[model samples]
Target: MVYDKVIEIIKEEFDVDEVNENTLLREDLGTDSIGLLELVMAIEEEFDIEIEDANLDDIKTVKDVVDSIEKIKG
Candidate 1:
């Protein structure tokens, strides 16, 4: 459930259509720092959870976001 919604959020935020678990946000989607911050904000609002600033550095792919959301929601 989280993965699907996350994919939607990412697609909307990045305006990309080909997003998957292994898709790299930076190398593949060309997501910059500001774009990442915006993505995180959207994810937080969608899930109603807080993602720490420190953890943002570890997010490299779509799966990472899904994992973070699952961990936070758990």
Candidate 2:
């Protein structure tokens, strides 16, 4: 459910149809660096959490973002 919520946030920000485990934030979703940052900020605000810049480096796909959120939530 968290993953779905995260994906919804991303979709709402980027106006995308769907995002899956393999969806690359940049390539598949057409998100540039600035867009990614904005998305991250929006996610932080929506979830009321902070995602570190270092941790964000490891996030490449939708699944990775979801996993990061789960880790933070845990």
Candidate 3:
């Protein structure tokens, strides 16, 4: 599942012990612009997909990332 895969990637990338749907990409995980770029690249490589930059602007939480991935995959 993209959600599970995305969460695992996020946890490892952010060095977080745990995360949930409500976890904020910026406030909760402390993701900066550069970190966000790295994360997007990582997810793209892991899933063999492309996450457009415009779409990224709408991503705020863990669930948002998963949903975006699902949309790209679909």
| All candidates: CA RMSD (Å) | 0.5, 1.0, 0.7
> Between prediction 2 and prediction 3, which has the larger lDDT?
3
Rank by lDDT (best first): 1, 3, 2
Error of 2 at 51 (Å): 0.3
**lDDT: the better of candidates 1 and 2:** 1
Each candidate's clash count: 0, 0, 0
- In terms of lDDT, model 2 sits at 0.86
Estimate, for each residue in 1-74, the C-alpha lDDT of model 3 and write its tens digit. 78888889998999998899889999999999889989999999999999999888898999998888888888
- Candidate 3 positional error at 70, Å: 0.5
Against the true structure, what is each candidate's TM-score?
0.98, 0.90, 0.95
- Give candidate 2's error at residue 54 in angstroms: 1.5
Alpha-carbon lDDT, every model: 0.96, 0.86, 0.91
Worst 10 residues of 2 by lDDT: 53-62
**Model 1 regions more than 4 Å off:** none
